[model samples]
Target chain A: MEAGGRLTEDALIARYFAPLAGAGADALRDDAATLTPSPGHDLVLTADAIVAGVHYFPEDPPASIARKALGVNLSDLAAKGALPRGFLLTLALPPDWTEAWLEGLADGLREASEAFGCPLLGGDTVRAAGPALLGITALGEVPAGRMVRRPTAQAGDRICVTGTIGDAALGLALRLTPEAPWAVALTEAERAHLLDRYLHPRPRLALAPALRRFASAAMDVSDGLVGDLAKMLRGAGRGAGVSLAAIPLSPAAASAVAAAPGLLDTAFTGGDDYEILCTVPPGQLDAFRGEALEAGIAVAVIGSVEAEAGAPVFSTEDGAPRAFASGSFSHF
Target chain B: MEAGGRLTEDALIARYFAPLAGAGADALRDDAATLTPSPGHDLVLTADAIVAGVHYFPEDPPASIARKALGVNLSDLAAKGALPRGFLLTLALPPDWTEAWLEGLADGLREASEAFGCPLLGGDTVRAAGPALLGITALGEVPAGRMVRRPTAQAGDRICVTGTIGDAALGLALRLTPEAPWAVALTEAERAHLLDRYLHPRPRLALAPALRRFASAAMDVSDGLVGDLAKMLRGAGRGAGVSLAAIPLSPAAASAVAAAPGLLDTAFTGGDDYEILCTVPPGQLDAFRGEALEAGIAVAVIGSVEAEAGAPVFSTEDGAPRAFASGSFSHF
Candidate 1:
């Protein structure tokens, strides 16, 4: 290939990635980016990497991979109550990579970049011996010292969750086994809903402003609700009383749980949900919910933070503590 | 493994990486980091990844691997004339990763972080099927809108480089074939010098301020000088006239070239120098040199930019041009 041919790194970047660069990216010609934070804001930074087979199947559509990668990082920014700024990408493609696949991924990145309002700043692209891995370092801006953080929830804080839980877990189950016994009971549309949830995570960025205004603490749910919420409280001398029945479930997840009630545990404990799990003080719960409703996001009060030191889940009917095999999935 | 087992992701970060976190990292208690850029400064961001077996030998010391990973990114920021603030890391280790290796890597990171003034802010750790890959997104601070950029070199500008040029190239040569004739002819200290240069890169952070103050255009020499210098001029209607004899070479590299005359080309064409390649207006060259001397960094002027559009090197004696098969090494 000539120096400027599409096969070379410079050509590849200029052809597929530069168009996504914005503002201070210098069209990615400078190999670095400069971000001048607005006077009143601080930068919230988060990085998340997804590997083929581990995070998603190698067969997953390129666009879906892009969505999941950007979605997961954007979700963290949203939970921190920050507005999107831009992102740096690290793409390590396997030796067997083909141009067609790369084009699909680039197109996927363009769509996700535009949708999340996170432009591509710059990135490192190289060929690795392993399966493909896409890592993103996303930058967001929050008013100085106003970023919602963990272990700040008070004893009376009402724990609320945005959107529904367990959809991702159910989606993964369906992907792993299209003929899962419970899946067989679902209609085609239900199956598609579950799969889409697993494939494309819709970040709840619309609620970011309200989160910083009203949330005492907040975290994005990635490693399941039970474990992630526990993480938010683990480092501090605090506990939470959660009603599993109050954890909103999507219509598809509800259908799956109805067909096989045991799947309820999977819904609550399985990972890859990107919704925001936050705590609102008793005084702010009404306004928080009102804002979430205005943002057109589903807000449900799942439980409350307590002075106790361990997480306890109840069915909310007879109020009996339930046992689970594990709190969340472990990559190790 | 238990939830807090050392093998688990959370435990791994807490045990080995969390201590490196500083300032807004919240001690890694939060999964993400917040960087509050000081007013009047812009955040200069850059990311680079090094994969084992591709960027380094799988058998290379874990500490050496860590140094290279941090050094390369820090070098970019240095070239940008930005002061290091903090960095985010993405570590994907192979399935066979050991605790001892991880411990060594962490210690290396601690040392580099302290030395570079760039603390670890946050990171993501995952397991991959292939060799380990270390990715870092480093942030630096520079005066707003003052970042020195590429393709800005003007005709009559002097081309300068810091430190010795080809030690890394020779070092890599020894590492691959310690029994080569050239290796057998070198002194023990000479061999060690070359190997050390290859194993650990010393980022010239000291020259950063001087670069931004005086350089019209600049870039780090990660790839060979021949190619990278060409890159600096390729986008613009500019070229350079370099005197090959003026290119600085360490005693070790000079010895290697004497033993194998052809190695001169490799010296100029090899990668991983991590030194700054910059252009200064002729009128400011003396002042730039003085500042570099104050910083205790060796700076050499080897070439001059011209209105012509291609990079051509001459042997000052005869003023004859030399031909090379390729300019820089292609990662692909």
Candidate 2:
């Protein structure tokens, strides 16, 4: 980590960055990343920061950190119905890490960049006095008039979510308490699957075009189901009532919930789900799910938008409704 | 600084972010920052990170930190011959800072965003177990074929630089050694002027169009003259020899160098100049300067590019040449 040695800043950049010939832009050594605006398309840009100990475990693998950094920003673009085009990375490194750490991190980013069809355009690297921090800015492109927004939901729109929910939350809980009976009883493959989902959640970019075509309002579920839904409701000047029984859960998550009744609280409040949450009109729900399936994304009808402006209500199958102590994870 | 309280994460984002809207992007509050690219213009994007203690003083004002975060990225755009359009900010906050610090930082960003005519498009905030870190991704627009790059400089190009150099370095020296006789003798106005130059650097966006017309290769001097020039030379596959006496120094810097012979070394090696270092053809030098003066930017002919490929050399008044150090500052 010593900056003044055989490998100077310029030398390191030449060694690592110069060889990266990006597909969508000129190589990484340019002053700025250049992009030709496609005809009749608008661009989308979003940046997110992931700090050690706050966003992920301090001992998390470098690859996981890299994936999470790009994944979170891609999730934002997915919510906006923008196809992944490119990204810029800003890395703040601590003094203790070896060069291997950086190389591994960069390898992971390169994998994600190529997989998502987003080239690494430009970025900066700096040394810091504390835990490592990573910041990623993802750029995307969408048809000019088809971008979905959070404030356009209607009163009668049906709420839908993509993919299974609460898997990552359950995975995190297991990681936090590894010695617990449930954690110990899980098969190795199951543990790996859950951990991978938590570490490297794939952004649902394939569903973006269809969502733009059918959904009225859309967003990514970063801060859990009920909390982010409430945000969309507030933004659209409406409210929602979600059915608890209708909440989709993976088989592992269902079994965990059965074992621990309080697991629903964790399911409702845990962050980093990274699934798309949107509202489609009742008449278009079938079409929306049909298109989503064609795009290889699973879909579930979660609830319906309400006419009244108030807190989001979660109703049980037995007609009882109760509020949870916490709605989502908050970083202040 | 606490995670959950009156000024919670949601409340803070609502208070500061809801009112901060970008000019052309309507979905700033949605999942991503939507940008409608102007017709016939390509997009230019760049990202830079500033780490506390490494990039600035630990006690630096929040306003200065915020400005530097955006200013350095804008400096890159200035080098690319792109118009200032919009930017994204990602901040990693230390746990001990007060809410007032966040407010002051946002206020400073807002001030610069308005002044530069670049709106704050989108960003993320997160907690960190380290010093405050700021990452900025700046986006700009340029005509399809006009985005200047560093590989276009030829062997016979006349190396040029904009504005006075060494002031920011001298300012840093003054700040660090306030008790020195030379620093103590400075007038209040001079001291304030020097420090202001260090804190709030104005990116030369106005000169970009003119640079695109005249310069062959362009880049900002973030890493001292010798270091950054070497980078541009590497990009252009050329070599350069700079005349030490020809380097433009402010009057205060000249006095400081005269007072302390080692101040020359500080002036030459100190980073954070934020001025454009470019290469223009010998025949175009006069026209370049004329256009620069008309655009209200000072220009200086400091060196010339050589046909041979080797390390950059700095020649004194008497024509004695020596190899310059590679990097100015060390992150670790």
Candidate 3:
């Protein structure tokens, strides 16, 4: 067709995508992919999109963008207490794409796909007149009737989070800042840690099994802990009291916050954390923590759910409520 | 959250998407959705995307855009001999999006989702600085190991296509022509017929069961019959010889072709013909045709597979090979 159109498209798939195709993908030749499920398991589905300029800098590395695209959807599956299975990718590329760019992207996708156990299925690639967009729909599996939900938190359940928070937010701030102030104050290792967390978030997939076994309610802390916890509380028709002093933070984030108290607001309101925020019953907190530790993940009890329904209260060590100028990061 | 960002997003989902969510969507409150697969079946996954100004006209109706986004993916499932199940949608909206536009889009998606038995599972909505984009990953189910493939056509297989092939190509030609001469020559009903074909393609899902039972190789004619047939043949490691006279054409398309013989190339090479192109064995031809008729679909045996592996040849009534300037319409 159109001189080299058909040949180009066929060759592109064969070269870049064929290697990523799983057993059900038919080497990317069939119109669709076939995924046979484990008889008694249920499939968890989630879709997410990242557009150029909105989600990442145009100058961002293609590999990082590719990993982020798949990682975001994987985070959703982890929050749902499902194990990553496979995914479909839709790439809307601009006219200026190059062979090197494509190779970089493929390399990144291959790495993430292998790391997460989510092989590529069938997808469409089309040219766009505007900025490029990367979209992915990830599929996961869990035992029947066992998916962790966000609206099942009960009164007296302890609010818990995995890993650390605010590193990504502070990292993004550092990345965007011109002649960054943290550059001189923080050690080189700490700066790199924050930047790495911002560019490549490690979704708490290791905690999914434990969450399914013990968590009363669960959601990924994407749009800041303050806002996401508020959403979970609102959905459960309950309230939460989070202790600012108990919130887990990376050593780098703590140093930045200590250096400039104003940075604390950025940590609380900025998003892109990608850490798991879950509620476990008081009786099961010890068990959940032990299991999480066994899985090589740090778990911390940050708050408790209350029967009274209202905005989540963030209390300081002095028992005074801390207020944020903004609740969560919103692209709009 | 930025003033109305989160609130607007919540309102949009509540107003337009909540009604379309299936049983496992959890009223769209959870980050992901759960789908229980039917026992003894494999899930067929397909994904497609459409961007403004590339796949459709900027001024086209929002409802039509929505249908095309989902319709393209449905055609993939049909070609694979699968039944519609559920889908996840990701939308990247421009700042100018309005409630009215969203309502129209939702109406179209809802209508198609119901008609195809593909319900909304879960999705993400995000803001973009560029043109809007819509992507969908459709899920379908078929009996284990029963999916129709493209690499099974034998040497003696009869190449058949459903419905008419050239209507959509001709319809698109008429649409792109400003102050068109054909408009005055064709009747109002005929003109509308051609326009409707271009705007909304009917995926041949009704004939899927027959295709699975009788067809040896199959694929939907998205990138024109000649090119797509060549693809099937390439996958099967075979070649084909088609008779140009045997190609089916609608009354409107027949009239247009009669008026301008040169339009034949456009009819043969233009893409967006969502009809099914399949190859049936000689022994199963009768059964396939009978079943297709019962399903109220037109089936035409316009070609035959050859032993040689090469580009497909299109022969005229005089037995002379006819050539097209291009094989298929390619966006690249």
Candidate 4:
């Protein structure tokens, strides 16, 4: 609005962002948003930030990038069995930001916020150097003293995961190394599936109620399943013996790994999976599975907690030891 | 630690940040932090993001940057009459980051979290492209329906501000142009005063209780005195005629402006002045001033709401209308 080719800060917020605000945001005119929690509910808070060309490609669709910023944080809440309440966004735009790109981002946020039941509260935007970054802080609600935690698994709990693992990692590999045998051997449908997995995260929020009622310990499987599970178990002062052969995989992922077997490591070690990895007590496993099924989410039983206080064990169906337990270490 | 030169993400968090965790953070080992608000309170939330080489010098002390990331957001909470509850951090480190730098940042956060009574609840860290970014989402609490808002000022209200206005702006001017006449004319104490104001923010949290009781409308003067004041006035559907002579200035700022009269514009229109600008009804002005004195914070009355609705007026001591009213515009 100032005619210097850059939108004034107030005008930018009013034009592009103010419409996305939800209840208690005061239409983003106030310095802060006021949220009155329902009686007997506790707030669950989580924050995640993504950088252009680091977490997502600079050329990726603007809308998907916006969604991912909120989606990843929502996934953390889902893992904790908290229903999405609202989210705050902090974005730094490079000098060359386009109005169309901003519109697309707002469109994406509008759709995702509506779909996830999380509305936009309030946020701040600033001008920065290159490689723009977007951060989100999502708040959720759970009944008092009822949030499932990461380090509460017992020795007899069953290890379960929602949805398949390794698809996003395999998809990332396909995007980065098209000439590789695994990438080249895929059919159009398989390629589409893998790339879609890499681009979009379907956070299993539908199963939050079931997870809250049934799970002993849980976490989002963003960093490889082996490493995340091992970390969770280690925190609980216990360990688990998981069968690598039993790890769930999508049809497209199965086909790609079948074409080039070494990608099995990539599938088990790469990040951005965003699936829910949870533990259920042996007595609650059946009910958890039944509830997950009724919620239209898949749950797989792959292992059991060991009664020992040592590092976790990953093995093949033949009971041979595998060594990728800390393979995700490279990511950190 | 892992075998690689890079600290594993988990180890980095555990070593440097876990000790700062407050209640319900689960020692930073959980998916999310659970916050149970006190009964009959509304949570006020605000988010602010700062980028290296943009917000502060790339060589600025790491701890200060960490503090500013949280400090600016806390200033917003103070303006809304919210008391500190807790905060979430989202940080991205450039590939060349060092452990020493990370430790300094953690140390700063620890001190600030303790000093403000705002604890580190939980956070996420990731490796990213160059030019690191830090974001803080701070949550505070206020008695229900009692938050001070920016657009609630009524006609005939007396506009007031806490602390001096132009020190941070003049300090920034000296930092960016030490050879300027104003910078060169300043004494060592004056220069130090300016630099400190620019480098750190003293959020006026002590005045929040009085503000909740007295202010009709409130907001943080972050952009600049004139522009920010005009913006606040316009938001409330009112206008004000403010006297430039009535604006409070530190002795250092007074000396700098005397040396180079033109820098007066910079003093009035520069960014990062984190003082509170509030409006009080005529009847409550004396009580508000008395309470502010009891709290040991300075309060200055600079202007009065105008009867007619139009762009606010800024005037010099000679009663001639001066026009730097929208001068902070270039910042956006």
Rank candidates, DockQ, best first.
Answer: 3, 1, 2, 4
lDDT of 2 at A313: 89
Stronger candidate by DockQ (2 vs 4): 2
- Two-way lDDT contest, 1 vs 3, winner: 1
Q: Is candidate 1 or candidate 3 better by TM-score?
A: 1
Candidate 2 — which residues are off by over 4 angstroms? A1-6, A17-21, B1-6, B25-27, B322-327, B330-332
lDDT of 1 by residue, A6-91 (tens): 48888888888999998999899996899987888999999989999889999998878988889999999999999999999999
| Superposed model 3: Cα runs more than 4 Å off | A1-7, A180-183, B1-7
Tens digits of per-residue lDDT, candidate 4, B1-332, equal 66657778888989998999999897898979999878999999998878887777879899888877778888999999999999988888887899999999999889888888899998788676667888899999999988899988888999998889888888777878999866888899999998988888888889889999999999998888888887787788789988888889999989988988887888888878899999999999999999999999999999988766666788899999988744673343
> DockQ for each candidate?
0.77, 0.75, 0.78, 0.73
Worst 10 residues of 1 chain A by lDDT: A1-10
Which pairs clash in the backbone of model 1?
Answer: none
The recovered share of true contacts, given per candidate in order, is 0.70, 0.86, 0.82, 0.79
Off by over 4 Å in 4: A329-332, B2-4, B329-332
Give the runs in model 1 whose Cα sits over 4 Å from its true position: A2-6, B2-6
The residue-level lDDT of candidate 2 at A285 comes to 87
Evaluate all candidate structures by whole-model CA lDDT and list the values in order.
Answer: 0.89, 0.81, 0.87, 0.86
- What are the clash counts of all predictions, listed in order? 0, 0, 1, 0
lDDT of 3 at A76: 88
